[model samples]
Target: MCRNFVILLFFHICGCKELFDFRDKNKGSNCDVVFLSDSVKNGTITSPLYPSPYPARTICRYEFQGRGKERVQTIFQEFNLYHPRDDNRECDNQDTLIAFVQIEGRMEKIDTFCGSTLPRPVMSNGPRLKLEFHAVYGSRYSRGFKATFSFIQNFGIKVGVQLPDYPCAFVFNSNETRSGHFYSPNYPGFYPRDTECYYFFHGNQGEKIHLHFNYFDVEGVFPCEAKSASDYVEFSNFVSQDRKYERHCGQLGEFDIESDRRFFRVTFKSNDRLDGTGFNATYQFLDKVESFTTRSELTNETAVLKDIDGFITILFFLMIKLIR
Candidate 1:
């Protein structure tokens, strides 16, 4: 009976897929449904009459499914939707493209896109992602959107038993390995709002953590103040107010930082407003002695050892001659 119920549910979802067609009405059928998964790794989705003004009262749904430890990544090639005309315009109540991700069995809105401007890439927090295109009834319509979707493996490890309070918290330990890399949540994509992610790095005794950012493009201005309400990334040995470095935001070139202590912490905070393509960094666990040692000092020590060895040899030969 249980197996029969599961089968019924599977077909029920398949039947629902027929309700939304990605092609224009004249195309006759929903012949192509891009359901991304492990085997069917990647595909594309487009609005009905994409590149052309979509018909009024149109709705479409695209589903992405990934296997364990995999997440969906979507990048739009073109986007031109009916966006709000307010001074502080946004995607609200217009022809909008929205993405929702499933987390712990519940669906949550991750992002909403409109306007002619192309959007930053997006990645899901879990294995399932759904994209909905809604075009409201109106006399005027805009060219819709087209995007490519793929299932990518998630590299971040959550810090918790079963499910953590903060799903984005992760730990990098020297005992696990000497070096590794990590990225902002949905990195190379616009991160979500109201999110605070923490990355903890712990080095073995006599070691320290060194970090270098490869790419950084978070939203905000210079001297990103924590109290000023902007998205920023910060690095420190402590999690409190006595931080070792300033908050980083906006765009940055490649840079390097080393932790003063064995434990290094990185925090990324985003507000409810703007977001941009986040960052990716590489980290290494360096021994304190190796990190502080200089090449010139090592060369001088080698010269001193050679001189001592020559003096000892001469003294031994003279003592042998006197004995003879």
Candidate 2:
């Protein structure tokens, strides 16, 4: 019994030693940098010494790759990096987190982030996304940042019609569905600066496209100052070069519109400067004859119901008089 107790105590001591050592490593020195795998549906990226003041002169790179039509999205849950002392709301490169997105084989979309305000969620336009975190030597090291990333599927049909050479352009046709919804790029979040996106809608013959915007908050003035450099949304019924379009901007909460023909187009343009949470809209293809015919029938039925009510009221009064 004495020998057995000695063996059990030795094993317990060894186990406790290993556990404490592992935790010590995780406390500060363990820079939790995890690379994404094809099988990984979601994961996290954190700075070295995360939750603790990160060490200076450290750099971490995270790459995300998705398959087929899947895209990458990331939301920063905790962000506290050192920025310039002037508090201008822009990072001076002392410590920063930068994102590079590859869209349509183009790397034109690059964003830089720093400071303590949590960043808006980011969605890559394509399957490839790269992130770099930098902490300059001898710079202030804060608690660092933690972000969660996942692979998500994009919306809209991608067949038949020719895709635009630019990013954020989509085509929708009635053949796929009679009704659908679309949102501004990075919607519910402030859109990127100096960006333009196009949405094309096609309907079958005898059908008109009806678009209803549930939310609209593009940054600009009402009627949109011509060439004054502000964000605005345009609606067009024609696809030709000289086709006329109506432009609107400012905080118009909700509105509805209908196309004069079977095709329609929407263009969202944003310039460098103030930005706003974009818009969300739904569209449907309505048969002109069926829609108007139903309305006409409903109107006639309402008139008949009114006449019947008046006749019943008159008959009730006459019966009361006879009883009296």
Candidate 3:
């Protein structure tokens, strides 16, 4: 009995030690960073030594991954970083706080901030958000920052698009194969500054995604300022970062896009200024590949084409003859 008790206690100690090992991986000497894979509706993020000057040579990244069509939003409860100059990443400047999205399976920075000026509430675009904090060795570190964030469910409302949920990139899986509509975060409302939103659409088997743009208005000129340039909308058949099939900006009338594959994506980004009413759009499943027309209808169309071709040929010959 005594021997059995010793073995049991040993096993328990081993188990506890393993648990601590896992936690230590998530711990830094003076940084707190995490990759939240689960759905987190509410939480707080703060520097490791918050309320005091953070340690020099520190780096942290917090990535929040939304569940399904959900997006994340964050409000800065407190922010104070050392920004001696306006430039944040000049090396030997000041501490820097940055926001990024997973593009092409890599972290692509979308915005950066420094200084005592607190940033406006920012949201992610798509299901994934990557936040970075670098306490470079520089002047005395300022008081670290504190923030609270939450997840928002986007069920595709039509009335108006809002931006609180720029915690973005709506992703649809095989389970959500039915027809649907996707509006901007707040359709009729003014979007927030430095906002990014992503929408991942996966079509059902044997079908492609069809989209109709009821309204599209954003800042900047067309083509040049659209897409990844400034405040614009982008569409991609594949879900890689910065890989765009078509990018759109400016006020648009009725327009439609048909996907060639079962996977597609759309993203909307707003800079710090000049936001508009945003966009309202709808999506449906289409099967152009497997579709067929009646035989008689096909024959009729072919005959019409032949007749037009013959008439055009004759007209061309007559004009040539007249010239001769």
Candidate 4:
């Protein structure tokens, strides 16, 4: 029954080919304020008056475009947007950082964040991404944000973007990379908020998977327990009910989990409030126990046991008749 559930869920949310059909979209129209473009495979962007207080009543917009069907991924190296109300600390209230994706001609707002914590990495659904910063009237207590962006190249039919090496930040999915060496969006650097990355690992038949983390850090400083509202990494198996998942946060250095079947899955989720530098991990296939017998041999053994039981029953009946 558990196996059936996994198979059902797997087919329910998958399709690789035709990942993006860049439609009749107005090219880079999401920037409503002062429009700017920095076309680079790897680069950085900072708020208007970064390191100093950002200007009041200002809106700055930027766009990162990848070649053809390629997509953009970004990391928030430093974030210190002003809070209009320190007590309430609303990101949309004063200075804010927002990310948008233009997919099939429609612009969708992907994330919005403010305050001190570095959020998780952000990945675009398509080839282009729009980034905006809005600062309201005052910059009294503010230090602007700094962000980095990179273009991700597509390799083959699976249709997912390839993740760069770690110690940096970005939203990363590992379904297509079966090699099992995947990292949190920005490793060594702090991750972003309102982020969720999924990884699916598959092993050879008759083999299991070994997964371990080299480093992990996430936000749990503010309590929002009812919704499991902490920045954490969750694990599960997609091929079986070996659902012993591991969730880690806040400077956990070394942790590991194993898979019961050929398929393993992992997820990293963060809240909009606070976060830390994310995690890094590796996975490898391991051979199963060698004392196993094939199905035909096992069936033959069962048949032999049944035959012996029948012979004993007949002998008992004969003895009873003789006694009578």
Q: Pick the candidate with the highest TM-score.
A: 1
Question: TM-score per candidate, in order?
Answer: 0.55, 0.55, 0.45, 0.47
Alpha-carbon runs more than 4 Å astray in model 3: 1-32, 35-39, 86-92, 138-141, 155-217, 222-324
Decide which is better by TM-score, 2 or 4: 2
Candidate 4 lDDT trough over 10 residues, lowest sum: 12-21
- Give candidate 1's TM-score: 0.55
The regions of model 4 sitting more than 4 angstroms off are 1-39, 87-90, 154-207, 211-282, 290-324
Residue 235 displacement in candidate 3 (angstroms)? 19
Per-residue CA lDDT of model 2 for 255-298, tens digit only, reads 78778889888888887556777888888888987553334568
Q: What digit string (tens of lDDT, one per residue) describes model 4 on residues 8-124?
A: 111111111111111122211112321122334666777754677666666667666556545566777788876746665446565677887664477767668777778766766
Clashes of 4: 11
lDDT of 3: 0.63
TM-score computed on alpha carbons, candidate 4: 0.47
Error of 2 at 256 (Å): 0.8
What lDDT score belongs to each candidate, Candidate 1 first?
0.71, 0.69, 0.63, 0.59
Clashing pairs in 1: none
For model 2, the superposed segments whose C-alpha errors exceed 4 Å read 1-44, 51-74, 77-118, 123-144, 148-167, 241-245, 290-324
Candidate 4's error at 227, in angstroms? Answer: 22
Q: Determine the C-alpha RMSD for candidate 2 after optimal superposition of all C-alphas.
A: 12.0
